[model samples]
Target: MCLLLRLWPVLSLLLLAACDQNQVFEKNADFDSYTWTVQEKPAFEFEIQDTTQRYNISFNVRNASMYGYYNLYVKHQLFGPDGKPISALLHQMILMDPQTGEPRGKGTGDIYDHQFVALRNQQFRQPGTYKIVLEQYMRQDQLPGIMAVGVRVAKAENK
Candidate 1:
């Protein structure tokens, strides 16, 4: 009885941490060479069952400290379930501080993880599977130090 009581707090915390009620979909695409090439485009498909709920879309990036540029550029396109393009844009994510060259986002040792918001309070028009494609948009043919890229869709909290 004493041991169970002592472990109750720890068990409660673990249970709470496992709950992510807002998460709809999250997936990552890893690069074997730790390099992202312009020709390599990663696409993610997720189903939208509820059109009334607003969602927040984010891009996840994991890079090494050796990444050459302070900012990463990419082009993202969203396609509806009917295979029609909905929106497309070129976005920039800051990975490091420009002046001090300090790496941004969550990091341990040399690796850093960044989550940049692509869309907030977004609602789907239709109920089906939607696709989002990400393409590296850089001057170089290949970008080094980029380990993986991912997409996350979650329910937006009402303010």
Candidate 2:
């Protein structure tokens, strides 16, 4: 009974994850030194079998509460399976409240996790693997207090 009780939380989490039918791909890259450098670009590749389905793409960030800036700048590039660029943009994500300096998203003590939508209701041109590359675009060559970065692609709900 005690073992089953302990396993209840894990089972609940697994059930929750299994209920996410729209999630297509999700991946995260961790920085061992808790720093993101200009040269360290994380790339995520996901296969799309349905070109007609619209999807939403989000960028995930995990940072320490002591992160220097209130906002984090990042460059995102999307490429098709043919390795041709589909879209590129420089996006700014707010990590904290500008006035109050309070952290955003879910937090556990000093660490916080954030997911910002980068693309919404986007449809793919072809049915193949697509790639997204993320780069830290801060002024400094090395951005501190960033623990991990990730990407999530999900099927958009019809409106």
Candidate 3:
């Protein structure tokens, strides 16, 4: 009984952390029944010094198994307070399978995982305001896949 009591608190904390940190994106406000298209283009815009650094965008997919393929992109210019774009960024995301033995482009007449994506700064130019876009191209729209993408603002490398 004593051991159980001690473990109870630990278990409770673990569960709470899992639920809280499991995702960064909220989907209820975003559509969940949309078909093979972006119901809404969700992106984050922020500014940073023009220097070299490695930036990473992490996306949380609610229905990871509901899609066959996924792709990510960035806007040419970021949204500004004046309701205009400030700069353009060419960043792309490459998705990877989280499921065991699940290959990419799977269920789309290929042998691969449902979808996966990742990106690095080397593939893009100097730091500036930008927009990240997530696109879906797949079959079976039973469950709408949810995604939350995060970008790290760092300096661009010196030439």
Candidate 4:
């Protein structure tokens, strides 16, 4: 009973550290075949319960070391709850260092994870469903070495 009591505080800290306090929505699409085709656009839909508060939107890219390009180009299209297009934009995310050619993400061996902030301090403006579609903008029809793609929406933190 003494040992159990001593470990309780450590165990509680671990559990609390694993929890995401500000995350509102997060989802991932895994590619079993490890390929992301241009036609296979992944769409992420999230609900906005409080439109008054601002949020930070981010994109998560998980790729293997075999990914050829040093950077990834993606096109994002956002739609409102009424199914109308809100905005569209293209973003370039650096995956590897240009000079050193070293991967620039958190990875154990070959697979690396990269998170790019797509939107910051942005208000949803509507308390309903919002959709975002992601498409690869590379010239190649199919992109390989991409294990998964994800979206994360979190409540903005005060500066």
Best-performing candidate as measured by lDDT: 2
User: Model 4: residues >4 Å from true position, as ranges?
Assistant: 1-18
Q: Report the lDDT tens digits of candidate 4 across residue range 49-82.
A: 9887899889988888899999999999999999
Candidate 4 Cα RMSD (Å): 7.2
Q: In candidate 1, how many Å is residue 154 off? A: 0.4
lDDT of 2 by residue, 106-130 (tens): 7556777788999999899999999
Tens-digit lDDT track of model 1 for 35-139 = 998889999999999999999999989887888999999899999999999999999999999999999877566777788999999899999999999999989
Candidate 4 Cα lDDT to native? 0.85
Q: What shift in Å separates residue 90 of candidate 1 from its native position after superposition?
A: 0.8
Model 1 Cα RMSD, 1 decimal: 7.2
lDDT: worst 10-residue window of model 3: 107-116
Of candidate 4, the 10-residue stretch with the lowest lDDT total is 5-14
Clashes of each: 0, 0, 19, 0
lDDT per residue as tens, model 3, 1-159: 756653453355346545753222222123445332444545655553333454433333322344444443433234444455444455443444445534343222221221222333432344454554444333333324432323333322334
Evaluated at residue 139, the lDDT of candidate 4 is: 93
Error of 1 at 59 (Å): 0.1
TM-score of each: 0.88, 0.89, 0.37, 0.87
